[model samples]
Target: MASQPEQRSKVARRALLGTALCAGLVATLLTTGPARADHRDDAWTVSAPAAHEPTAHIRLDDTTGTVSLSVTRRGRTVIEPSPVGIVTEQADLSEGLRFLHRKDRLVDERYRAKSGKRLDRRVRMNETRLSFATPTGARLDLVVRASADGVAYRYVLPGGYGAVLGETSAFNLPPDASAWLGAYRVDNEGQFAQYTAATAPTGEYSDQALFETDGGYTLLAESDLTGDYSGARLAHDQGTGTYRIELADDRVQADGPLATPWRAMVTGDLATVTRSTFTDDLAPASKVPDGSWIKPGTVLWTWLAGGREAGQSLAAQKAYVDYAAERNWPYEAVDAGWYFKAGEWDTTDPDWQTNSWMPELVDYARAKGVGIIVWIHQRELDTPEERAQWLPTLERWGVKGVKIDFMDSEAQPMLRWYDAVLAETAAHHLMVDFHGSTLPKGIQRTWPHVMTLEGVAGEEKRTNTAAHLTTLPFTRNVIGSMDFTPGAFQRVGLRPNSDAAEVGLTVAYESGLQMFAGTPESYDRRPLARAYFDQVPAAWDDTRLLTGRPGREAVLARRGGDRWFLGGVYAGAARTAEVPLTVGPGRWLVETVEDGADGLVRNRRVLRGGDTFAVEVVANGGFAGIACRWRPGVTTCHR
Candidate 1:
């Protein structure tokens, strides 16, 4: 029965207790741990239990007070150097720092994720912090926590350090590292391009990029992002195979002390990185205790190829709702132009820009067991004045959420707007899906209702390929939910998919809104396809990327409502692979779908102690999915 203030006080106390624990560990490490004494004379070296992770150590330069990370596997150094920070302060912080104190400890912490495959929400890390200050009074701390599977670190800027111009944190990889940068090309339609550290273009922005080194794989991402800083992009350094932080804005000014976003890396195993909730761990725990209304389910997009008329007219919207309701889909999205006529949205005369059909359409959809979501230009919701009036108005209209698009920037102001909108929408108990925005940096961890984001080269693209499909799991989607706007069974497009491939897209991509980009008429033809989506979930309880080759193949397993839906994509001539799955030991009733050369075919089988299964995909074709359930120990976790 504690108030909010009391809860906050307890959190502060816990943080102090953690700090104390860290200090005690520091002494233990310095005196008794198997640390190289020369590290203090040269660079303070850090490690986590094994040799395969030779390059995963964090190195702190004692003299310069600079921190960088390098990971090695099998004697090969994969990440040579990735600097942690570069703050512009009056006093010298680069060198001549009199070491103040240090902390080292084993950290164990856990919290519940608002919505995700809620497994292993906690992390046990080998933690440490090196506190340093200058005689001129500049003080800072380089704190790092490394686990057997991942590593996260941040720079703590004490309030007295004057103003910070910005950061110079950079990731410098080795030549052999392969990276998948979001939106590598394709005229910004949202698609990822896979490249090597030696080949990725410079000056380009990627939400989060991956480095496949001999040391395993390193998923580099930003976490627990707060403050006035702009979004961080990986600007490639071709010659040195490094990436520097090209912040969206020049500087972030704060009156109080600020801790930069955690520069996190998960390197070791692909599944270890793939299944990580570390980013969510960095964010504060969910605020909503009873989030029953924050529904995560498939929604139909009216603007998917064709629906503008259907989106605007009460009759057409009703038809779409009929389809959605029949399939048990919870919501439908009305994209662009439903609110007001084109070019008249900002008219001082509100009636000129308003649409009269919206109210009736909302009622029609609501009566049919479906909720309505409208799309808005993000710029329209940038201000409190705009949101205060608009949000309440939308709430009154019975809308569930809004898809706000055209962000196109990662500047500090844009970052501020991101939080502001989420806060307002949350207050009104409405959901938000961001588009034309950069990749999500654990924002959903803080605001669960802030569902999916369009930072990847998703299905909305004029064209999408199996290659793009394969690349997503390794790059665009690892940090948080990605709204690819899937389901393109339209039988046309530069990169159209087979019925099976489309099913695979639904399983592969995780979003707050699992939308089938194809129209109802298109899906209706393939009742089997509709049946797959009818039972699939927008979010999952757990996920496993069984086998994949970037731009070549991806096989994945997702659990929903206690059942597992397994899917995969193969862009080449029909070939088969043994897909590994992590299922609890049991007997399972498995229902499968695969490409039947011209279309998709479905069948069922029973599996015992489900581990790995073999399947084939047609050349340039793929397997959509197969539904599986434990016959003995049934668990409807999401129902």
Candidate 2:
């Protein structure tokens, strides 16, 4: 057995030798291959002999330098430097060890510092290594390894500031070779019991990936804390067969944060290989489930003003219902105050339970074809006494869903209380919306009834600006569906106040059940925007990343059947962005973006097979619903 220092020294030499051997092996197998370019202009390219195989080559080029990586079957990649200027430094070897009872091998690795900062240490393993070479010719190497199920990755840089990100065994599972990735944060006191339960069934081979890319950082957990999975956020891609989890926070990080590193057992099954990445504002690409009871594109109403107070007069309540009916919006919500008095100190009156305005409002909304959701504080229902008092009453009201609010952040008891809330809600065949809460783990996958959460600083806060709205999609939204209360008809702020264009942005954003928060009268005033909202579907069958950089600008294209909706948003300043519409080869009837100048503009244009179109858009402003219909013959059209 080699000493740790000896092993560290052998890594670079061994890697080079291994690469030579692999290259030779490949040559022996094939005489003719794809033409290899010795040198070419910079671009990032990935190549794999076949999709089913585990090996691949990745090339990255930037103004600073170029990085080339060769990934092997065992989840290890070798990086080589290109002739570009980027400085790299090395640090002292720091070793960390983790033991996994399932896999017999001891995952051992030494850490290195690249930036002389412990937090920025680069983790590398025997099979997995990261290196950097500055165009100036400086290089740094980071090495890592795994002990059975545990991983030992090291970050190496120039300074003495280096620490190994290691994990100690706290929980165990039976051995299984399935890849599982989750976006989760480590809550010292367990809160995610259900999450733990979900991963436990997969056996001990499950490696939980925790990340803090949304600014606040935490460890990803394999099990639940107390009863709630506090650190986890909602995200689209929870690794396939392997559980993929996401962690989220509302506070924005200056630079994009690192998502929890993916951890999964190596398997031939592509579905079993869990993969994920962290982004400031990235939404999931998957569609919400479909069923008669739970359909996509349904609008939920929330009666935030005390139901009795807001709808005190039947005429007033009926007016709102009439507004919904006229607008074709589907549902209505009876928020918090409806359960008790709006401002009274002694609000909880046991006798006043059924006599509230909720029942009447529910009946009226039902007759108007609008569904009603009730609001309940989680604290009130934390115990058996609370649950006994509230659950039955809510079920009896025949409410569509309950918006649970004011959940405690770190308390284990509160976590457990939330889990019970979901179970109880599901048992009653009711849907749920978590408010004043954190990001979602993968609970929705197991309990598809849970719709959205208000972890974001949505429109409710009158101070929210366009920057906040623009930032949410890339940062907070990356986790999962956020009930951002998108449609705010009121204009509260200054220059970048919420407007029809902003409303259009929200519709373009993803959500399972969207809430249109504002007086229906406000929506009626903006008919064009209203028409666009009418077109916005709650769930999307497919999503494509059109163009734009993170935060600065983003343009997204989504589709439900043959219809395509395109939206673009800019954060700080007004700028022009080129959006590439290249989903498929088909002629599209394009609308000449109506910027509120002329009545809705429409243009008939035909696109040829295998062609790309570039559309120019302005800054701080965006284009939406420039509808595209597949036209087979029509060619050029006047702009």
Candidate 3:
């Protein structure tokens, strides 16, 4: 007889093969569902029952592969995906549904109270049918609704409770082919709290995504609520795959009165491929679309050189702006201490008076065709007094945005306070970038004006080495936008050195708004590297994932019309790999090779019509920004 271990291995292999077969069959069947339709001006659609029917309909644009899920009942469009595309959609009927895996079967169901009040029933995992009660005192059976676009698992609510809470999770695979999950929360207007847990097969908390809804028609919050669970929290365990979500909200909260609908997307797989593809699917389907809400480029600022009093460093500020303007970059930033050094929470610092030089920096940037964003510490802006006084003044000074830093932790009060800040900033037409903060949990979608947040120890931390840069996209970026100060051309210490290659890595790592955080002279020293910076936009209309492996290697492709940008990084030792180019049809001019101490090896080449290209690259060292143009009938070659 075979040994026990051998038998177990055989069994595991068989199970894996069986699961693969099942997955393939399911994918085939799903692909045959309804073909993607074109975008039409149809009435909005709501989650009304089949009896009442959908009074309105949401049209999907096949060209852009964008879906418009509208709420017809209220005559309002609740949520629209980003111009990119929809990743995935998962649905559930009721809250508190327990999922159980038995030896032979997988049981998932929920229950309700005898009085039809709340979900106060139990779900048992046994060799029986999955059952749950409706709010109208009726028992309903669950069914699977699969489609080509995605799978939709539906259920009926008991009673006259027309409210439904569904969790839809989407995913995108970037150039690196790393997976990122985008989870969405859908529920009627009500007080709802959704809890997401990413656990391993053993059910350990690898990550957590949460959203609390007050009351609104839409299911997903436009901006993430600032509180204990404001940012997307990651799991300490790096190997978590399985995720579970639980949502709870009374019908009263579901109603439109003092309640708002709940909606959210949660995932921690920040590989470039996942985010790019997911963003592509979620984008809105509209001709002449306006992406002003999505800030896609990098910011050139003089923070590190002058520190808190960067605004006082007028020469440095002017030089930075000149560098950005010369490169055709969009914006430059002036960090804190420009206003006044009112010890922590001192908003009344006399320096904030009309005589401050920060406002002059903003004006100077504007004159140079560059936008200026100032930084403000949270302690000063937390109170109503400070908000009313300073926010208006900052807006009056023509500040494009404010980087609110030092938001201590993930507490409920802090979350609420952050929410208020976002709201107030929006009121003043001032964009926000939360720094010294927590992770992002899809808040930028609603308040598109909220540019970026600093959750991870980004480029600002000079200690960030090339190795650390390789680990970020797969981890912190999975949740949402990271305000990582990208461009740094100075070589400081040994282990964690900053150079033009690192600046190139910033664009490659998939940051929406990149902050050029080095001396102005550094940028001047590297014009070719600066050329890449000039081309990098703060916002993107479409993103594509080419290839990647979490904490190891990642490659991404982003598109801004005719121009194409490709970036990749490797965290471990030197290695080689092939990455695919998925930016539609075109001849790509690739100017790339590993950068070493001596200089760049002239390996500028051209790539013709091909799906995937085999390229040799080093570990920790990577390639970025391959500018491609359509050269019909011409093959690309090394220069």
Candidate 4:
């Protein structure tokens, strides 16, 4: 019942394996088996053993010597033929190459996560590597991986040293595909917008661009971006429906055998795409000696309300600490200008205020069961010498965390600096939150002490639109922890979304260091909203996108311990969202806070799994709630 081509393929595989065994290559046989050489078209196929898993096809053009790739999932095309190669300062590795050999194996790795959407993660996939030699005899390898959720590939240059000019990596989508992407910026603060393949802006775009194609959904993103290469952006070619990888800087260096970051196409349905951990899976394992010290919880910040003055004033910081202690929040962040004047990073300056009351404030907060997070500019502590001098000092003062701000660069040097700083900070048992920084490339996995990063159009800008808020879950926030600094309840100023939606963002946004920016008095005015934030956690054990449409609405359920926190946000028009109760089987007491046409309203009810919980959400409105397993004595749930 086998076709002619299938018979030849079987013979080739058997012959290749027999030869490898005869050659006494037991290590290679166990890990990589043998490379099946196809004389027909010089193309190799790698797919997950499961029928539902994704499949990738790689081809090396004999005539042009260019490598191209295509992918399919569940018998549907996820990516068309797309060119993938890198350009170095020495040779044109993109074309005019000769095939040398190939190797492949299946990788199934499971690791425990300290703080993320999932507590435990498994990276199960089939990996194939194709080696080629350039005209100048430079060796390069194209490693492709196909998993249950997506396809990922990267270029590895052996014995590479010097400058890497650029990359020819691109994603070719269907002509009719639509995309939700954020514009590329150093700080990555642009709002996401929608566009058809042909109408997408030709400018640069940030990571994690979600596309809706005829076959299924595909999320374009990158991972494992280290100091060896520059941070990359997507440059669109509308006519060809292609988005090419463009390096952030021209001076990308490769000091050794260089391995480019994985360019991933996360493919499947919306839920599959949203739940995919392929990005984090591609990153290196945790480097922290012990992640138990890195606690995740709510933080009270003062910069949003009173700016630098409040963060510098001792009394204001103490008051904020008292409020955090009273609310049982874990941390209070005293932002920039804590011990130095604005634009004055040099501690040697005569007016550096060396005798400030930071030690007293830290002691005060520590006694009240609260920790202090101090802010410092990038210039003050960029080098190893500076970090070595300051990290131990902060630890001595009982500082629990540090907020490093104004990085504003993603060049190769800056990327390396991030890694070094995280290592040094971890040595001192202090967590890190990067502000005005580059987008997260799954670095939190490698450094568990990295709590969050400000790489989005967060609440501080005071220009957040409802559409932007709704789009983040499916776009920016999916890659890693995003520091949106949600829960700003101030009524004055040009606030666009509803009060309920603003309150709901504390749950909607995923951040290890979830900062509630509202002042104590402002939170006192809305006790119901404050009470919701009082109990909701910053990190989660499990996450599910109950229902979502980018730039329209996103309803999510995140579980912490036995309690599940639910959040939803809508844009454009008023509508009724049907939130399915899919937590599990059993009776659950659901307490919800939603938009009440006049303001925020709270309601409680008992529901079972597979029930449809209907909500009346107004234009640009949102909702937040809690759900707990019901027992005979369980009468009330946290609101």
Best by lDDT: 4
Compute each candidate's TM-score over C-alphas.
0.86, 0.57, 0.60, 0.92
For each candidate, what is the lDDT?
0.68, 0.43, 0.46, 0.80
lDDT of 4 by residue, 542-597 (tens): 88888889888888889998999988888988888788988888999988898785
What order do candidates take by lDDT, descending? 4, 1, 3, 2
Model 4, runs deviating above 4 Å: 1-41, 342-346, 349-354, 491-493
Q: Against the correct fold, how does model 1 do in TM-score?
A: 0.86
By TM-score, highest first, what's the ranking? 4, 1, 3, 2
What is the Cα-based TM-score of model 2?
A: 0.57
- Point to the candidate with the largest TM-score: 4
The digit string of per-residue lDDT tens for model 1 on 192-264 reads 6678887876556464677887667878788877545556666665555877665555545655666777877
Q: TM-score of model 4 relative to the true fold?
A: 0.92
Q: Lowest-lDDT window of 10 residues in candidate 4? A: 21-30
- Whole-model lDDT, candidate 1? 0.68
Quality of model 3 by C-alpha lDDT = 0.46
* Between candidates 2 and 3, the lDDT winner: 3
